[model samples]
Target: GGLPYVLTAHEGSAAFAADVMGRLTGAPGLCIATLGPGATNLTTGVGNAYLDRSPLLALTCNLPTAQLGRRIQMAIDHHALFRPLTKATLALREGAVASVLAEALQVALSEPLGPVHLDLPEDVALAPATEAVPAPPSGRRLAAAPEPARRRAAELLGAARRPVAVLGSSAMRLRNPGLLQAVIERHRLPFATTTMAKGMISEEHPLSLGCIERARRQVQRELLGGADLVVGLGYDVVEVEYEAWLGKVPLLSIDVDPVDADASVTIAHEVVGDLDASLGWLAQLPPARPEWGADLAARHRERFQRALRPPRAGFVPHHAIDVVRAALPRDGILAFDVGAHTHQIASQWTAHAPRTFLITNGWSSMGFGLPAAIAAKLACPERPVVAIVGDGCFQMTVGEVAVARRLGLSLPIVVLDDGWLSLIQVKQVRRRFGLYGTDLGEQALVDPPAHYFGVPAIGAGSAAELARALTDALVADHPTVIEARVDPGHYLDTVYD
Candidate 1:
């Protein structure tokens, strides 16, 4: 009764559930599937979660050892296939269930938290084993900054006149929302977050600059390049181009793993420690005077304020996001998939609390939103959960809609129908690269829109239509989907360009 779950109609949804759950919940998220195709169908989601460095555990059933190579149709190389997608992949021995489960969890939760896979033979789940359950091992250390490293990081942040902390997916995973806020408030640091770290600190907080698309904001980019001390708190390399753009700024890197710490550029100091513990140590240190950073913070705040203005009319994408925010519950949960819509939602939505939003930060996978929405609703059924996805993404896992209906999951899904692979199109436009397979022009937008089982559904063409659709969907008692048809040109101009 305490948690809500979405058993999507397909394996892709299962993978998405694992990712979304991993993103929102600090603990490792788990997903299970039957043998054969159920396991293969989850490939994309698993890869996405793995690449994004979400803490996830995926369990898939396999053909019994007795039938391993007897030409059975269900028999295939699941273990080998999943090897590349997970940091560790183990085939569960019939009598070693306890050990396998323990190992899988340990690896998934270890430093640089990422997905782990355990393939169980079908017979193991049904067979009786006489072996003793092994105790989970100790001394499997997670990464954290040592005392000296912590002191160094603190000294850097404490002394720098113009210092700023850039938060990332790892910070969200470390579960130190209050730490960021404390440091920001204490030093009056105006911080920016990558799309994945949207809800780490409530956007309404005074120090929050906004969800930063690194390519577009010139002033924020300049500030990042020029800051004397760039405190990367749990920042991941995949989310930001720090090496290329951060200029000569010295980075005081703090994260859960050595790999993430190693990816830092212009490092004056590195602290690989549990994020919370490191932050706690830093919290004990005196705040550095905000001499050089105060004016810079004010200027960035002004730019941030101007950028917060949502487009008022026409078929603008930002306006659609505003409509959803206005219509939904302020405490509502937003589960976003990776695509053009992901950044737009993060930039536009105001995350007011922790666990209120989810994103595929590490991998930026496309078909994650619907499954995440289901998982969020399952975890917190009473709160409204909104999923923002792309039309291509919707079609990738649209069948999950039926799963939501059958399972009685009440989620409102918003599909951005830009008809083309908007992100790729933008990349193509900017680089003058010949586009190969990224176009989705022939794809259908469901002019009338499709329903989620019995839930109401509509296809919106204008800003007013989206507002009306969202109003009812947000208030509806059951599942609903609003497919907003958008112009392909309306997106984060920087990244796409």
Candidate 2:
């Protein structure tokens, strides 16, 4: 296979890297692992692909055919271990390598793309065989739903007093966003994006309601509360259920597949087929002059902007994010780790392009930032890539710094240092519980190693210092870790829903 690969620090790291590669490249990303412990570590990222609908192929080594059932070292029921975590669990039989591989790829990249596990027994690891013809990838350019269904969908939009649209994770697969944006503009619809779908359209676009899961989520949710029609364009219910947001509102779905609307969400009409074709159909429908005053999305967008303004002057998360945003170019890739910082960036960061902002809203794993950034850099070397991790997240994946250094990857690892699991701490406090296990002991990166396994480690105490550090890392030969010592006070002040 001509596919690119990296020797990651851990099996989990490799899988996460594959996950990002799949999302960014719109093809199956492949990761190889050894038996037992290696197979076990891959579950987190593999599960992320399962729920997130990313195309991934997880190849693992196992005991030889005769010894597979015995209690040999590093032997376990791998098929059982991965069955629940993958779309399909397959094995390499004597002469079926080619066919098994073809099936695995077909399943991994099918509708609602997900991870597929392929186990290669030791004896068959180096075997050569005739290659089987792989199934052709599914065509996404199908005609929009039947004319009656589309007309009904259009009729619902035409008759509704207030209709809103939501862009979901599936939108990332869009080959032409211009068509999607045309439909949004033609209808003058207000729109909100799921966390993972951030930047399908520019967050700064006048029609954007920003992301709906964090930072003033109440404001965004309330905007969706009064909708008469909710247009779910390529929206996948895994990131958010229709019941939580849309409630009993009538839904019109336009995507490559039928929308997974919850029971409470009435299917007013569904235009299921090619998204661009549906969007083209919507664009051609005589523009409907609805009852919404002005564009509700653009109007609410102002309120969202007001709420996200720099709330305090200290070296806080919001301010730190502002600095990073300013230093990063419009095309730079930001891979965010899961934590309190995720809540802030998901809403506050201004994303102009799809796949430029990578976060795991489906599985939402910690320690995802480093590997994701590394893989993103590998995929698109011309674009600058940075990993924004929390203090806790940095500790969990710190060993990957060695991987970054070894590869001479020009990636920057930015750690927001508050020394605790801030997101979980908020929940504990809400329950009137003490800090307990959330604390990470030390708050400062005192006497931080000058070089982490040959990669430089630097400290930034203020916004100005952080900007300088990021600027330098962009041109560095290897990975640079910048510990931005920031206060966590702003997290409690701003993040919500």
Return the TM-score for candidate 1, rounded to 2 decimals. 0.89
Best candidate (score: TM-score): 2
Q: Give the distance in Å from residue 206's predicted Cα in candidate 2 to where it truly belongs.
A: 1.9
| Candidate 2 lDDT trough over 10 residues, lowest sum | 135-144
What lDDT score is found at residue 207 in candidate 1?
65
- Looking at candidate 1, what is the lDDT of residue 4? 45
Per-residue lDDT tens digits for candidate 2, residues 358-424, read 9998888998899999989988999999889999998889999999988889998999998889998
Error of 1 at 315 (Å): 1.5
TM agreement with the true structure for every prediction: 0.89, 0.94
Give lDDT tens digits, candidate 1, residues 1-497: 54445466888778878776766655677778877788888787888878787678888888877777566887778878899999899888877888877888878877667788888887887888777867744324555566777777777787888777888777776555788778677777778787777777877766676766533455456667766887777777787566655767787777765534335466787788678878777766787776654355556666754564434445766767778788777689888777766656766677877678777766666777888888888767778888888878887887888877887766778888877777777777678888867877645634743555566678888878888777777667678888888765655453432
